[model samples]
Target: MSGLETEKELAEEFVLAAFEKDDRRTIRRMLTSDALVYTPNVPGPGLDVDEFESQILDAFHGAFPDLSIAVESLVSEGATVVCRFTMTGTHEGVFRGIEPSGETVLVTGVVELRLTGSGIADVWQTTDSLALLEQIAAYDHENVRGERGS
Candidate 1:
């Protein structure tokens, strides 16, 4: 396999270990020490890979223990792999400040994983954050109605 293919495999293993296996340490060991997580929802310039794993990995995995991500498609070039995939899970724990609503959320996103000699160099990604918030019963529908003076 080429560098891109190997990187893609590593990325898949990381995701599987995260969502399917719920092994945070396995995924943690796979990330670069200087990795950055740029998510709109999280309040930070960026979260280090380890912090990202600690803060999110288990909460999401605990909430959606059966969470699974499928790589719907991919485009590989050299050491870069751009993956398009869907993430499906159920709300079995609190996400953000909201309590679990026992809702199932299936969100889609694209991630570009760049690989180095050691492992993944960096990952740039985004997903439907609003949709996910809504799915988790985080959005205040009553507030919207309240604003409308219902």
Candidate 2:
């Protein structure tokens, strides 16, 4: 296979290991020790591998115990692969400071992964947080309208 094809395959494996299998060890092995992750929901410059595994992966699993990711597509060029995926789960635990509503949520997201010979080096990810919140009834539309009128 070509290099791009190899990279795409790696990206697929990464996604399967991380989200489908929920294998933290495989994820850690796939990432460089100092891998940097960038996400809108996270504050600061970026997150290292450890932080990404804990704050994002672990916390998300805690919030949505039965969460599953369905990969819609993957595109690769050079050493970078972009994956589009859909996440579905029931909100059973607190997430982003919002209490659980036991509502099902479906959110779409994209993640770009930059790979090195050793492992994945950098990641940039974004998800539809507003849609997730809406699905969970976290936003009060009436209150927002009243505040707007005020």
Candidate 3:
């Protein structure tokens, strides 16, 4: 296989090994020193390798202990690889201050990875976050009422 194809294959392997298997070693090996991970859910500065592992990776692992990610498609061109995947998991642990809802959520997302040498240099990701929140009944909040008493 050509170099680009090899890189794409490596990236695919990295995603599966990291997310599905929750293998921290694989993740560390696959990310570059200056890697940047961008996610729509988290605004402001981009996530570095440590932040991605702790916030995104480990958080998901904690929330959805039995999470599974299925790759729908993987396309590569030059130094970039785009991955489309479907993630399904049960809400079993506290996530982002929300208690366990015991809800099973299925969300789809696409990740664009830029490879440097044999490691991923940067990642841009977007997912169906609204679906996840709805599945967990995140919007089922009590309405506030105002009282007038003088």
Candidate 4:
């Protein structure tokens, strides 16, 4: 395969494996020795290899009892993969300060990844968690108030 294909393939493999397995180990296996991960849900400036991988795996496991991602689009240039995808999961656990509402959410995002030697070198991702929260009724205070007639 071409260099671009190799990079793209690895990047795709990363997310697919993580989804299929629903485990952090899959994520770890996909990264390079020095990987950078950027996420909006996370506080502070992005994280390095160990911390980044750990945080998302924890977040996913916490946010969705069964979280998985589907690749919606992909573009590649040399060793970088730009991906757009949907993450679907059932909220069975607390997430983002909201209690479990037992709702299913599908959030979309754009992710840019760099590949190094066919492994993911770095990733920057931005996702629409607001839509997910809306779907899950995370901010249902108005509805609650209306029911109480307050």
Query: For this target, which candidate reaches the highest lDDT against the unseen true structure?
Result: 2
Candidate 1 lDDT over 56-134, as tens digits, reads 6756776777687887877778877787879998888777667878888999877777777777667766778777887
Worst 10 residues of 1 by lDDT: 35-44
For residues 1-150, could you state the per-residue lDDT of candidate 2 as single tens digits? 888888888888888777667788888899998899899988988899788878888767888889888889999987889999998999999887888899988999988999999999998978898788888865877787899999
- The predicted structure with the larger TM-score, 2 or 3, is 2
Segments of candidate 1 deviating more than 4 angstroms: 138-150
> Which predicted model would earn the best TM-score?
2
Clashing pairs in 4: none
Superposed by TM-score, candidate 4 places the C-alpha of residue 15 at a distance from the truth, in angstroms, of 1.2
lDDT of 1: 0.74
TM agreement with the true structure for every prediction: 0.80, 0.89, 0.86, 0.80
> Which ten residues in a row are the worst by lDDT in model 4?
15-24
* Cα lDDT for residue 111, candidate 3: 86
List runs of model 4 lying over 4 Å from the truth.
138-150
- The better-scoring model by lDDT among 1 and 4 is 4
lDDT of each: 0.74, 0.86, 0.83, 0.76
lDDT for model 3: 0.83
lDDT of 4 by residue, 34-126 (tens): 788888888887788677656776666777868778888889987779988898889888776778888888888788888776478788977
The residue-by-residue lDDT of candidate 3 on 46-88, one tens digit each, is 8998888888888788988998999998898988999899989
